[model samples]
Target: MNDDLRRAVRQVLPGVRTDLDALVRIPSVSAAPGSVEQVRRSAEMTARLFKDAGAPDVEILDDIEDGLPAVLARYPAPPGQPTVLLYAHHDVQPAGSPGQWSSPPFEPTERDGRLYGRGAADDKAGIAAHLAALRAYSGRPPVGVTVLVEGEEEIGSPNLGTFLARHKDKLDADVIVLADADNLTTGTPCLTTALRGMAACVVELRALEGGVHSGSYGGGVPDALTALCRLLATLHDEQGNVAVEGLATAVPPGAPVSEAGFRAEAGLLEGVQLLGSGSIAERIWAKPAATVLGIDAPPVATASPTLTPVARAKVGLRVAPGDDALKARKALAGHLRHHTPWGLQVTVVEAEVAQPFVIDARGPAFDAARRAYGEAYGNDVVDIGSGGSIPFVAEFADAYPQAAILIASAGADADSRAHGADESLNLADFERACLAETLLLAELTRSG
Candidate 1:
């Protein structure tokens, strides 16, 4: 079986590059118009690969509502074997301002052993990895397999929770292979065990009726922009810690981010002091992170604004895995509403919220992943937590409590630029992930 799988994988290896490049060329940006049709085409292409790999039933379900089409394929369980739900997304983030790219963002190119193109790394490569894994099993994997390829994960998976809830029984599995994350660093297999929850709100304050002459009304009329700025200012203390009274929480011990790594990843300038005191892991995973995403005001180019009547700022709050998004949103809204310096009325618009996810570390699934990665890489898997939230992971965990959810992704290479102008993935790392997936499936089959 191993030899057969190996040969099948090798046969598919040369085509992986071709498949990824072909898909990347489609410009399937889910957020843009005419992109949904491209996304649907990609789904159809993906479904065909699964059918060729050995799936017995493959179907594409279009929007029962406002959702990108989801592709599901089922491979029945071999006697006494366990099923693995393979999850991936087909849609890609808009390749913002393609002019910023070294090459055309849609043209997959290889430089210094890295494939570069929009969606090449962020997730198209992930989709390729899933196809490669299925090819390795030759469609008749040792374990049962069902794939849930979502089309709108980049937009926070607004419709997936409902889809999962409706199809919960059909999707039950012993393990969930969420092939959407990356290793901690290149070649170092990373096992993501936790993700921070996220919630966003825009605080708008209106003090005056409309813009008034700055010189004339500067003293008598309260500046709405000033009041909004003050309200935003109160959100963080002098040292940059979130001063929102009830939002912050304690961080866990694992998933440490060294100061050096943080600086490098965040592109911190020299001589700049790092704000907030705590372990990098704690600061990112277990604690709350607040950011004033954007301010709504006249641009500097359009100067000479009279006393502005209204000003608003979009705020993003990242809560710990245990922090409640709704409660946090309410607390933040109330704080802003109560803390306005002047008598300006405040309006807070709740943008979006996603519950955090914490994978239980002590489980057979974790052990199998550790061992599979160890066998493939000759090293222990590193534990890490993501600051960004993938809501579907939380929803999946909620729906299938018994399943061991594992994220084996190839995202660590700097060359694997996801969401950037030119994104790519390491061919070697992708192959390693495919091998690991194969081993994991075999391990799960034997474990039961």
Candidate 2:
């Protein structure tokens, strides 16, 4: 069985690369300004790919108001066979600067056996993996299959709950395979078992009614930007741990991560000290981390000697695995309010907060996945926690508590630099992932 599936995946490699490259060529940055048309084009292209692969006719569902389109198609289950839902997203993050990339961010390039592009590893590769797995059996798997390719995962998938609620009958399955995580290393497979939740907010500080000349009021008065900076400083202590009091922390169970390996994978500059205490994995995967994503302030080029009246900053928080995202968001907001510098008037515009989740991965579904990935990679699978958050996973679990949810990476690793310039996918692991999924389908059908 394994040999046949390997040969099937090997035969499909050329077409897989061809389609993966084609998908990577589209600049489908869902959050970028003026990207509606590009996102639509991506959804259309994804639908066509699945339809051409011999699945049932696909549908591009965009009925939700003010929401991006998502493509979905399903193959009915045969008698006494369990159904599986394969999930991935088509959206990519905005490319910051073309000069920062070795190749054009939108143009796929292959070097050193890696495919380079914006969405190549982050999620476009995931879509390609699903296509390859279905095409491995010529789109008629032994078990029932449902493919749902969403378009807004990069923006935290705000509309996914709505979609899930509306499409329950079409999406429910015995098992869910979410291929949007990261492996431990190149050629090393990781079965993600937990994820830190996510939260965000924008805080605005107002110091004065209007701007004033620095020469006239610099020493005696304060600028809102400076006051905002001071207030933001209170969010962290001297050791760089999050200062929010209500947020909870945990000690995640995983293989210890050496500081040297962490430094190399993170691309830290020479002499930059690591933050906070315990092991590297515990600090990142088990603790709440806060960051200022962007500031709505005067540009450096446009700065002048003036006491700015107002300043706003966006705060992104990765909630720890054991904490509540809503409570953490309130804690952050409370800290900002109480720590307001110089009694400055502050307004915290709270954003979405997705609660952290721990998947129940100890049953037959997981056992089958482990055997499949181990056989495909010729190595034992390691379990890891994602420092990043996927709200949709938690939502799917909530919607169907009895279903088994398995999170695995399509091909991303620490070096992929997802959401950063020069993002790339390891092609060898990509093929292995396709083979693993194809084998998993057979495992499910055979065991049942």
Best-matching candidate per TM-score: 2
Tens-digit per-residue lDDT, 82-193, candidate 1: 9989888888889889788888888989887788888887777777777787777767778888888888888888887778877778799989888888666677788888
Which tens-of-lDDT digit does each residue in 303-363 have in candidate 2? 9999999999999899998788988998888888888888888999899789898876788
TM-score between candidate 1 and the true structure: 0.94
Clashing pairs in 1: 53-139, 54-139, 182-411
Worst 10 residues of 2 by lDDT: 250-259
**Candidates' TM-scores?**
0.94, 0.98
- Top lDDT: which candidate number? 2
TM-score of candidate 2 versus the correct structure, residues matched by position: 0.98
Candidate 1 Cα outliers beyond 4 Å, as residue runs: 1-7, 248-250, 253-255, 413-417
lDDT of model 1, residue 16 = 69
